[model samples]
Target: MGKATGFLEYTRINPKKRSPEERIRDWNEIRLPRDPEVVKTQGARCMNCGIPFCHSGVLLNGMASGCPLHNLIPEWNGLIYKGQWEEAYKRLTRTSPFPEFTSRVCPAPCEGACTEGHILESVTINSLEYEIIEKAFAEGWVVPRKGKATGRKIAIVGSGPAGLSAAYYLNTVGHEVTVYERSDRVGGLMMYGIPNMKLEKRIVERRFVLLKESGINFILNTEVGNDIPAQELVDQYDAVVLCAGATKARGLDVEGSQLKGVHYAVDFLGVNTKSLLDSNLQDGKFISAEGKNVIIIGGGDTGTDCVATSIRHGCKSVYQFEIMPEPPAQRIEESNPWPEWPKKLKVDYGQEEAISLSGKDPRNYLISTKKMAGNEKGEVKEVHTVEIAWVKNASGRMVPQEVPGTEKVWQADLVLLAMGFLGPEDRIADELKLDRDSRSNVKAEYEVFQTNLDKVFTAGDMRRGQSLIVWALQEGKLAAREVDKYLMGKSVIK
Candidate 1:
């Protein structure tokens, strides 16, 4: 520990955010420049807990409690506090291959499981991570580190976090790696699914450039099961790793779901980002929310992103509906003890923008959408919703039961369904004849990452269902080791 009493002497602080009023008018990131001294102070707040749970990466009550990558939190915090910026960056990259992506968008479970957070606020682990990586880039510490060629070729499908991480590790181990992306650009979710305001496209592009420089080949606008035959990849490459991600969006099964203005959140966000990148959004090739009353179904990060995106689109108003009950503002001590991931209310940036613009939080909890009403032109105009109560059914399982006489209708022209993904799109799995889990995720075990078919491996959301980027990175690293072992009968990838 840099300072034994540092935690007691310092309080946690996050980076400043751009004012909602000013930030909403543009597509730039809402975060302000971070102060180095403030980041050092934040790092000093990391208590030297003998049994630090911040890196445990365990799932408590179905939620992540710490960094999934098992980051060396205390070591980096000490390094940062001692003003060893380069050393801190080195320690950070040792576990996380892409701190830039996680720092921007990952829900920091490390902070949630911080020892100091047992009583007070947690240390700003995510912000500190961002600062460390950005400094590394600025100091030119980030450079290509290619390994000697092993005369082996590996093909990776998908260019998301998992695929990228696997390529990084495998390429560093002397194998020639090639990444295939269906989209014209790299970074599947980070480039398209996420709004530009959250993770700027240039940040993703920067990594792409560095990756190419490191001798990894990226084939854009290529789909494995479509443009390129899946069997061909299996026969050509020494090993094939699938990190295509779980992108099958859960659909709204209500009436008028097929209406013109109704769209999946992923499609809406992807289109907007693509348009923004191609022509600064002047092409009008995306679904516009301008002057329309927007209704977002779901309450997770995706729905929150939709709320924020709609606000930036100059939507007349926004309303978010969540089927679950609102969580407590503070942790319930008896159930949610210290070191567990707190199941408490969190007002994310989108809700903050909604509050700033609408004078109230736009979330309506314990409400379920009943149906959508469309106008004569086949465009959605209103959403019918009903209040719900969770009650124990005959099976003793809690189920949402609609409250009678509580149905309400709200005016809406654009409806975004962000209820999360069900599983990976079945096309790739089917084309490859790969086994699937009961939940439709690609059948592969953790750590092993081997599919039923030989020479085929799977990782990331594609295997585990929808999950965090940190988990994707972890899966990729593990899968790379398995592939390496499969290729050479042994692996040196750690």
Candidate 2:
């Protein structure tokens, strides 16, 4: 707990961000660092609740209610309040392997679950975590950890958060870990799927350096099911943990979906990041929105990212379409009560930049794309859409009913689909003949993490479908524990 009256005495203060106008000029991280004294005060705002639901790590109404990794938020907050920097770092690293990643990208369900947030402003737990981890690195306190050799080997597919987490723990417990990634770089989505302004590539590279120093090997530009068969990994390593994320992006089904200028949001973000890192966008390898009117389908994080990226590319104009209705500005207490992830409207960095550039938010709510039109060259030129209302069907399930008079056409030179993912790809599962769930995710139970094959384990989006990075990190940790148990009959990972 923090000071007895700290919650009453201090108010929450978040870190500042670089002005959108200034940040859009480059791909650097947008968040500015908070002063040490200010961070301490923010930490002091944590209320010493009788029951801390910030670390409950439960699912509520299909959304994460608290820290999925069960981060010791209150303890770290108290430590930071006392200026015990090293102690806070230690407490944070106890459960969180990648505080840097989560602090930057996670929606921070812990804050929504914060007891103080029910009545007052919540503690800046996410900001405090970022400060602690960065300070830990600065003080040279963070280092690679390896245990006595257990003479076992683990092959992890995908270099995403889950795979990296499992590799960190498995290597720490003296197991030889080899990670396979189809991408040229480490940190699967973190490196590519996410844009650099949100999470700088150097930050991911820093962690990758530490992981390599800790004796984990990475095979780059090699597909597990293609380059080397899925069976080959199981035959070589004592255990195999699949962390390949849910990469099979859901595609549009309407007419003109095959237009040349239409692309997946994943490819748009990934190629932009890759080209930026490779040549600072000097190469024309990425899909450009420069001087073109863009239309983005689906309004999630990916859609938001597409909007920002299009703005940065100097797109003439951009619009994002969402099939779902817009959320309330404030959480509806009747339907979404305290301690559950707030179902409210959030203006993220992308929207902020777009609003700064254009005098209005670029998102369109309750709109569905009817079809697309292309020019003679077969590139996307226009998008047809209609407004719809959510009405109950005969079966009592809500469905979209089109509003007849709301038909509209939008000028669109490039169309990006950000409708999220269906599940993991089919190559590995088909080749290995692995069982799949109803959602087409790899059939691996939580905690156990073991698939039909005894040695074949799975985690992350590949197992749970599209989810937050915090959940992936936790799954990786738990899956590592399961692999350790299988290898040595017992594990000291926890």
Candidate 3:
């Protein structure tokens, strides 16, 4: 829907970013300014395909096909092509509540599913989205719409993207909303787990300030299961939406796992980032990687962040291990297609920084740690590792099989386990007596978002396993709609 020849004429161009050396020195966002017209040129690359799979948000054949929120991709692109920044921004907010967060951290599944991405680089939809949202914010076009009173009260748990999104919509509908967070801060994982280099805390704080100004109540250090029981939440508010998150981290069962130097990635990232914010490097209160060889387990975003953080911490060296084999640089023909997520090797920002700091990539794929070696003093001294290969099982699913002679050892003074999460904590589910899905997430239907317990609901990682922030926000919005409907017997929100 952009210019007739726009997609054919212009190539994709991403916004310029500050060098890794410069960005790592401060906690600000890693981006530099981009010319608006240049962003429009990038937006113009969106081909007007009959089926825009970018908003599908579902995994087809193990790949993401579209935008989960069904964002008006082509319409916005068309507006931007015509230099309609305000219109483009308006269209964007029609679906996503926080375009700024998606612009920074989202994997850009839309670009992966773009029709043009089959042979050439996808349209710079991500950068375009970023530009539109930022412009809207800059122009003061993003003001809270205080609606006429619906006179409903809603309680939302865990102030992550999901809870925040729900509060935004519910508040817009004039439902008095109170968000409760167990942590001292509002953002659940966003405030702590994610490193500042990826998304600066100031950005989150800025939006939080807007939310507060918009009349949403934020109650920090209030745990639903502890400070206030789930039943109290049910009695105190008309409806409750659980966005408690999949916080229980997965762990390694190997020898010396409990060594003093080994720490959970969440705890490590949280403490380190908090320390950075509270006292910029002067008060070395958090865990330090300075002048030490660090070993990180797992290869997801958290692991990558640990690698990047370790580099910034002035680590002597760093290593990351993933049990699965490295993915292909391009999509697999058997499963992936032009309109589906490409299963490819992606170098995220952290990996890029790690490569720049170290001589080569810090990842050792298809490898498993057999044991953590420690001195008699009980602090981690080294780690024993083994490389492995994959073989198709009877069901044709690939499984890791270790190579007998591939065992090796690496020396490390500190160990960080970024092995991902294990769904929601047991305490919440057990206390509420809520049913769980096979994945151990709360058993709640999509859009319905209700728990097994009467008048209780769930959203975000607690309902679905650990997922993208965009997915969490969508789930939160949908869950809030369900809760609102249950409380008021029908909702304008979908």
lDDT of 2: 0.93
Model 1 lDDT, residue 472, Cα: 95
- Model 1 C-alpha lDDT versus the unseen true structure: 0.92
Cα lDDT computed for each candidate against the true fold: 0.92, 0.93, 0.86
lDDT tens readout by residue for model 2, 1-494 = 77889888888777899999999998889999888789988888888688999999999989999899999898999998899999999999999998999999998999999999998878888888889999999999999998888889899999999999999999999999999999999999999999998899999999999999999999999999999899999898899999999999999999999999999999999999999999999998899999999999998888888998999899999999999988999989999999998889989899999899888989999999999999999988999999999999999999999999999999999999999999999999999999999999999989999999869999999999999999999999999999999989999887
How far off is model 2, as Cα RMSD?
0.8
Model 3 Cα lDDT, one tens digit per residue, 72-119: 899999899888889898899999999998898888888888878887
Candidate 2: stretches off by over 4 Å: none
Decreasing TM-score order of the candidates: 2, 1, 3
- Candidate 1, residues 1-494, lDDT tens digits: the string is 86888888987777899988888898998888877788888888888789888999999988889999999999999999899999999999998898999999999999889988988898888999989999999999999878888898999999999999999999988899999999999999989899998999999999999999999999999988999888899999999999999999999988999999999999999999999999988999998999999999998999999999999899999999999999999999899887788889999989999999879999999999999999999999999999999999999999999999999999999999999999998778998889998999999899999999889999999999999999999999999999999888898887
Could you give the C-alpha RMSD of every candidate to the true structure, in order shown? 0.9, 0.8, 1.4
- Poorly placed runs, candidate 1 (over 4 Å): none
Candidates, ranked, lDDT: 2, 1, 3
After TM-score superposition, what is the CA distance of residue 465 in candidate 2 from its true location, in Å? 0.4
| TM-score, cand. 3 vs. native | 0.97
TM-score (C-alpha, index-matched) for candidate 2? 0.99
Report the poorest 10 consecutive residues by lDDT, candidate 3: 56-65
